[model samples]
Target: MFSLADLPDTIPIFPLPGALLLPRARLPLHIFEPRYLAMLDDCLKTQHRLIGMVQPQEGSAMSAGRLHGIGCAGRVTQFSETEDGRYMITLTGISRFRFSRDVTGFSPYVKAEVSWPDFQRDLGGEEEDPDFDREVFLKLLSRYFEVAGLETDWSNLEEADDELLINSLSMLCPFAVEEKQALLEAPQLVDRRQTLTALMDFTCRGGSSAPDELLQ
Candidate 1:
């Protein structure tokens, strides 16, 4: 239940590739690396318990690669420490942020200053895709799933609400990293649905997985 005012100007960032966390969606992460473990420990002591989930882009000389410009900030809602000393946590997406610049520091993990003005809607409650056509979308999804050799419970997807179904699919779908980023950057629920549908359709048509071609 974090309001816009509760969000911080800076937060610890976890730059994971192909991990897409949209607003109001939930992302479960396993923290095993020493730096991230330390990051999690520090986050626990804070009131907001927020972490920026960003994706690392390719073609970077740095070991962690260059981070994407935009990322979603999620609050640690559920947390548990495993017997092996790893941290398992579920981050409920609070909002998407525009990455300003990295804050150089002694901290092992990356930290950055972020702004949320561009995505004020992310702090709002669940959104409805009024234009969503479930049956058609599902049919397209079935074909895409079949082509991709993926399986799922049709009943569960059908039962989910508009936001849940779209966000879940956008997160779980085996699309390319940049495609996932495009979905994350989509301006609205309807726009996300269209982007997702286009990606699936492109894949179904035996298109290349290259992000440039897929998005174009």
Candidate 2:
């Protein structure tokens, strides 16, 4: 069994993969799944059900439903109940966590004790990447859209901040699973930016010659 001895006593957790929540980000979630609904209810009652967003491993029965080791913890900041019995909620990321242990409890969702060592932004922190080329990113993204024949709202794209722009594109770009995992596990914003540039370049080139390969 895993242990929680080294982790913080209280932390809200949402263990969902394919969802990456970063600080200062507002992720809109459609909460219709029952297990996750229970998790939301628990969070509503507690006022801070921290969620650790991570991806599930591929082809591993033992780790099938469990989360990976690394994730970001998001707090349930805004919530409303929809007429369809679904929840329209927004999560504001607080910290990045490492799963130390999974708590066996009555809750349908698994809880992991986590540590937030790299949560804060500082001089040496991952947030210190200053050379992000927004103009270059936008040009490449525009070319990518044309090559793929995609329709998007460029107005919204223009106003997004660095994190939102990068993470949003990363989230929706239809990249490979392993590629998405690499983006998620990228240690710094600067590194993520670099990866985004490289991926965009690949998409632009491969998209023109072989659309299938670009998508793959």
Candidate with the greatest TM-score versus the true structure: 1
Tens digits of per-residue lDDT for model 1, 78-142: 99999999988999999999999888889998889999888989988899998899999999999
Candidate 1 local Cα displacement, residue 172, angstroms? 0.6
lDDT of each: 0.88, 0.65
For candidate 1, the TM-score is 0.95
Ten contiguous residues with the weakest lDDT in model 1: 56-65
Writing each residue's lDDT as its tens digit, candidate 2 over 67-151 gives 5676766677888998888999888766666777777778776666767665444112225457877788799899887876787
lDDT of 2 at 56: 64
Query: Which residue pairs does candidate 2 place in steric collision?
Result: 12-50, 13-50, 13-51, 14-51, 14-52, 17-54
Q: Estimate each model's TM-score.
A: 0.95, 0.78
Top of the candidates by lDDT: 1
